[model samples]
Target: MSQIPKIPRRIVTGIKNGRSVITDDAIATNVSEHFPGLIISDIWATSQMPADLSTEIIVENTAFPVVPANGSYFRYVSIPPDKDLGIKPLEAGQVHPLMHKTATLDYIIILSGEIYMILDEEETLLKAGDIVIQRGTNHAWSNRSDTHCIQLAVLLAAN
Candidate 1:
């Protein structure tokens, strides 16, 4: 299997003594492997709407909730090729093992490589620079290419 690339650096800015300053600038560390070769890096989060900027942003290293109640989540995901993970192509009238739903509105941007967005009854190929506004739905991502597919996603809690 090919190696997954490192997560990108995160730069955060905030007010310091009434002047804007770079508060955090470093490679993101809240990374986890959900599957054999699938990686997710939780970059940041907010616990409420009209987020309080006065408070320090503390990114927790614990397992993140799928959809934070009345909050938002920002993360990057790296999906390895399905073949490398021993996942075979779906047969007709089949459902992927990873097909699931979340109570969040997801904004996804493909950062590199390509992947297939598998819907309940259809699928579409997404490549670098492609964007997806995924409402709460049952879906899955399948990477059939030879390399990893990296994507940046922001999930907002939905009613």
Candidate 2:
């Protein structure tokens, strides 16, 4: 078996031609383990889900009610249709705004495909399994890949 590689987290984009890119994807890494391509839906359970327990998600307008499933862990799913696909030709470091449930901490995770997360002037790349804790911050998920970017969010309720 090939060893898993490590990539430093930062703002990087447009390295599609680089072989090192496939290694950067935390999702693609798992996909390469046994299955080929991005058909690894089997790894998106509550236990395997990325993000913190205090999270909530609303995708394409589909609202996933908050669930407290563990001592300090939880996640939510906002299916497509509610998420407004942003403008085309998404730049390398542009922050797209996403609406979140009023009064909550949202932890975003990608279920499938690649999603570029923009928070302010910082943009981070997330693949399946990669998690980001959005603590009352403005953000958006952009699908630069040629596939649908399914995502799961864990939102911490704001008191």
Total clashes, candidate 1? 0
True-structure RMSD, every candidate: 1.9, 15.0
lDDT tens per residue, model 1, 40-140: 88888887887777654455543334655888888888999998778999889888888888889999999999999999978999999999999998999
Compared with the true structure, what per-residue lDDT tens digits does model 2 show for residues 1-159? 111222112222233555334222343222211121212222122322344433222222213233334212233232222132334554565434342333456666776656777666676778888887776566665556555556655554544
For candidate 2, the per-residue lDDT at 127 reads 81
Q: Candidate 2: misplaced stretches above 4 Å?
A: 1-86, 90-102
In order of listing, the candidates' clash counts read 0, 15
Give stretches of model 1 more than 4 Å off. 56-65
Q: Which run of 10 residues does model 2 get worst, by summed lDDT?
A: 32-41
